[model samples]
Target: MNTIHFTNLPDDLPVAENEEQKKQELEFLKSAFQTFNETTRHLQESYDKLQERLNALDLELEAKNLELEKNLQEKERVKNYLNNILESLTTGVIVVDKNTRITTFNKTAGIILGMTAGQCLNQPLADTGIQPLAELVQSSGGQTRMEDHEITTRDQRQVHIRLSASPVQDPAGHRMGTVLILQDITQLKRLEEEAQRNQRLRAMGEMAAGIAHEIRNPLGGIELFASMLKKDLAQDPEKRPLTEHIISGVKNMDRIISSLLLFAKSPEPSRQQCNLNHLLKDIVNASADFQCPDNVKIHHDLAVGEAVAAGDEELLRQVFLNFIRNAVQAMPDGGSLRLTTQTGNTADSRSHITVTVADTGVGIAAQDQKNIFNPFFSTKDKGTGLGLAIAHNIIKAHQGTIDVESETGQGTKFIIKIPAWDEN
Candidate 1:
């Protein structure tokens, strides 16, 4: 504001002015004083209005600050929620930015890839040392999705993987990054293959059973004719030997046909309380007299209390005998043959009979162990290759399982599990 100065008298004021002039000066003073009073009032009114505007601005700023803070807190809560969901998933999750740099690596991702999150997070996909994932992500710039793509893990275990790649975009439809989902389907794949293999085996078994029936028809006639011939040639020594040979060949063929039928068309085992201890002892005695070498040492660990099984006694005996013979065959140059039996209950509270036939001899080749129970698979030249196969069928018919464990140059062990008889 500009200041105004007032004086008591002007420099050119007339001396001894009249009463009217004095009165005029007084009125001028009154006017200047009135104007000063009005100016002061106007200034006060303006200051009050300015104060109101400042207070309003302060209120607006505070409201805006609170709103901004709330938005930030909500965003943080959402981020944590999403992280929790990703972490809890069994399937693996990996995220990459537009530059193919890994942005998020979940725990499942770390486990499936056999790497740590720190080893991959924020790193370029190309340098992560996981080629399958890198190539999959780089394929079509992560826009194209790959589903159920199988990949072998770093540890060389075959894993069935269902991998998918999807692009991440912002609300404005702009390209942001990519997301990769991984799932382990190894067990599912094994079950699928096992189902397919079982179907094939079933078909093959049906065909073989039919062929066995067809062969048996002719074999019955041959045996009858050979018997008649043997009697007719009984008086002639040379001719009688030839007829006997013919009959012997027919019998062997019939025996093989019976074995084939047993393998192909497995018979249902008669449910009975089979005492494995007595059965095993009888088999051991028979083997000692026949197939078991004099140099081979036999050790039995058959306990007294491990008694009964819910299986046909004859069939169970056949299974155990087959295992014993295989174990003995494995040891040609004198080795220990161990046979053990025990009764145990499984986690499901079902009792089972555990039998192990192990030997200290040249072991089966690793490749052959899987095929040992398969028909016509044998490493020995004289092997008809049906012994273990028939044994496997009988065990299966009795609701049992058989598995072989062996390594090249190491001893082999056969583990058999059968459902035990419930006395209750």
Candidate 2:
């Protein structure tokens, strides 16, 4: 255990050394404080600038989001408006995918096709089983338009359609689908056929009139000479029979000339409102008394109570009488004759009177039907064939229509439609 002892020094000894050490220690503390305060101020300023920049970015983002939302709403509204327009169109529109499956079908398309959109949707064209549309699509070759194409429906009704097809494509020019437009032209086609028929009849009437005039001059002399010869042969029984035959031939020729004259000179209709049912009944009564065969029974079925039409009385009477006589003559082996009258509206919504004379006899052939109304065209083994030609002209002058429907071994029906008079 060693111990050492030290003596205490005076307070005033080595003052410079002590003062220098205290000054160095105080300066070090001041420098550290200044550095700490400067660092704290810089950190606070940096944090404030970062927060301001963040707030500005948030406002810009909100503006962009609002603009985007507005654009989306505008696009949605445009899409709805286009859809409405498409649905309102009268012409049929059909859209198909690349695989030939129907994608869109408008209301008119459904009506024209006789199928619903739901039934056709997402189904292949061949699967839809519409032969006309399928054939059209195949012939279209995905690029061309076909116009005025005629097709018969499932129910055997004929239709005229104008079709146009175009291929749908993406921005990259790849075909996406096909769009088809169909327009109905059935009524237009009917009107055209009527005009053509009328023209042909007019030409034939003119030609028949000229021929009749040429034959009449010689026919008058033949009739006069035959009558003189008949009087001379009154003394001879055998010669009298030959002269009678000559007279009968002259009378037949005169009747043919009269028929040709009637066909060529189309009289203007003096239209008056008349009871069509009563007129038809009178015609039937007259026919039964004289023209109609005793074996052919007549049936009157007037469904309409007040069947009336605007027409010339004399001309219409002739038309009805001719129809009845033809119907009675058709039934050589004793068939029934049905005369039906009714009031109905036409396709254009016009009220009209309709008369149908049907006969249960051997029907007319299809090839002969087309020429039945033409002058000098007849199947009957008789005198001239001008009865129907005259009848057609009379009906046409009265703004009426007469058509025939017949099938082999079935029966024959003649339909007459005349416009009704609006007394009001």
Candidate 3:
């Protein structure tokens, strides 16, 4: 082997190293560089695209969050509005679960039921202790409809309540609960009752006046002839008895005619300032002369106040006398009669004095109660039935009112309200 220097290379030495090897080395190097550059560009493009996608996603999420917040706010607003409406409604509203447990009770419900929301909430229908309501709800099936129900209050007051019940259901149509709307018909019922009474009174009055007018002439002739016959038969003993009977009958007929006249006449009230307490005391004193039974007891609860009213004294006296007499007659089996007088403001904010007569006697029937103030409508055989009618008219003339509360076999109470004299 010849020891040649590495720096000293001969041109075209070593047979030119194979052309195929050189070409292969060059091709491999070119291919590696191209692959590296392509990978780098692809990574950069992919990163940029991922960054754009992330930004778009973030924007979308932000918009979705805002939309969600808006929806929540709108829902809250709707909820608040509904709550306010329910709170402000005059008619009572109550929501109950499927088990009839109270879920919500509004302000008016509190007043009508005489119970607070705190007391009523979560209470079962049976636990409410309202007999009418408990019975009604229990009997009502899964029917979702409204019905009118009458309930008696805790104070023994009759209330006409209109109960409207609707079924609460889920979006899937599954039965959830019930929503009950309570409407107070006490005043409405009273007005209806008053209207009916007035209609009956008008009809009866017209008929009575017509009949009385026709009968009065005949009655007068009968009385005149009876008087003349009594005078002519005075000397005949046998005819005297018959004439006496005729005279007695004529006098009775005259008395009936007088009552008829009183009934037919609708006198306008001549209002004057008078002390009601004194008048009530006089009425009590005058009642002593009445032939009341020994078993009946009368009590007076006259409040010490300025009991001045603008009304007719004589007519008012008759009104009270009729009430007292009726009360006395009510208690044939011995019961206490209480008369109370007090001054108060009416629901309409009118200053008035109230006189109440309560008797523990067989009460007027419900059917009869509506017609009690109509002329010729009487339960008693002998009653002309115009006493209450006249009393009703007298109170109305005075711009006052009269109401009766009664339960069959329980008792009866009559309330007379008259406007107080305005000193100012």
Candidate 4:
């Protein structure tokens, strides 16, 4: 602190000293005022500029916040869209981590696999009971695509599948897991098989036609001569055996020729409203005298009343006769034969009569089942192999289908469908 001491001369001082002191004080005050004004002006300008900069920053911050919220909403929308697509896909989609634990099993996947998404998620791929998927995980090196891979389900139903797999990776190319896409192709596979079968049948029919024409004339003469020889040697026991052998051989050849012709012929069915129940009864009665094993038993489950079908009675009779004969022959060891007939509607809403011939006999081998209806294909040593083929043709001519269900050692069932009489 600076102390200023004023002498008594300040009240009444000498003229030079007083005037000088007063002038100096006045100059000092003017200088202080000028400095204060300059400082105030500088501070005001700085404050104004600072406030303007803060306002600009506030505006920028608000804009950024809005933009950030918009980006977040857009990202959320994209995420939902992707999720919906994954859920809606028909192909089974499965995603697993590097440890082979399932992360995502979509709705289609759950349905096709006979499992729920909740049941499969977090479960190991190997534990999912899907061998192809597990194999994909084990063999996953890079992207892989497989088609028409067959798999049997837990219920013993076979399914054909197509699979595509790729390893999920990050931006740095580190392996994360696998993404698998599965599609069911069982129906498509059946169509292909049917197409192939039709082609083979067409060719076989053409070939059999020429062969039947060449063989039938000779076969008729042989059968005639054998019959005459049998009549001439009827009294001689030793010669009778030879004649009988000749007669049997000729008869067998004639049957073969006849079967071949029947298989090759495309007969236009003379459609009629025939009662299937009566037809089936007539078939059973006609076969009553046919030689079957003594122990063999035949049971009937024919639908009562009018089991009417629209087809040529003769052709249908032949079809049923062939089926019944096969059933009887199959039960060589004296097993039961069930003949069932019922009325039903097909998938296209057409009424049809279904006849099931199930026999507890030596069942057809799995490998031979597909070719059972093909010409010249038979499992029996004495079978001409043309009976079922002819029966198939007749049923097809009537716009129906024949299907067989059999497993080795489990007997066999033949289901024949013939459209019922529709007046409309």
lDDT winner: 4
Clashing pairs in 1: none
Candidate 4: global Cα-lDDT?
0.83
Off by over 4 Å in 1: 1-69, 97-102, 107-132, 138-157, 170-178, 216-252, 275-304, 327-349, 356-373, 402-415
Q: Rate the local accuracy (lDDT) of all candidates.
A: 0.80, 0.81, 0.80, 0.83
C-alpha positional error of residue 79 in candidate 2 after TM-score superposition, expressed in Å: 5.1
What lDDT is reached at residue 177 by model 1? 88
What tens-digit string does per-residue lDDT give for candidate 2 at 1-424?
1222333434674878767756765676576667777777888898889889989989999999999999999999998898788888999999888878998888887776666888888899777665666666777776766656776654455568877888888899988888888888777876887689778878877888899899998888988898899898889998899978988988888888888888898768897987878888787675454566788998999965688889888888878888887877778898899989888899899999899999998889977887788777878899367778888898888878888999877789999999987887
The TM-scores of all predictions, comma-separated, are: 0.66, 0.72, 0.69, 0.75
Per-residue lDDT of 330-411 in model 4, one digit per residue for the tens?
Answer: 7777888888889989999988999899999888987788788877787779998888888888898899889899877778
lDDT assessment of candidate 3 = 0.80
| Lowest summed lDDT window (length 10), candidate 1 | 1-10
Which candidate number maximizes TM-score? 4
Candidate 1 lDDT over 115-221, as tens digits, reads: 78898888997775666777777785737677675665666545678888888889998878888889888779867855765576677678888998999999899
Q: Report how far off residue 250 is in candidate 4 (Å).
A: 0.9
Q: Give me the overall lDDT of model 1.
A: 0.80
Model 3 off-target regions past 4 Å?
Answer: 1-84, 96-102, 113-144, 153-156, 172-175, 232-250, 284-300, 303-306, 333-337, 406-411
* Candidate 3 colliding pairs: none
Name the runs in model 4 displaced over 4 angstroms: 1-84, 171-175, 227-236, 288-294
Error of 3 at 236 (Å): 6.2
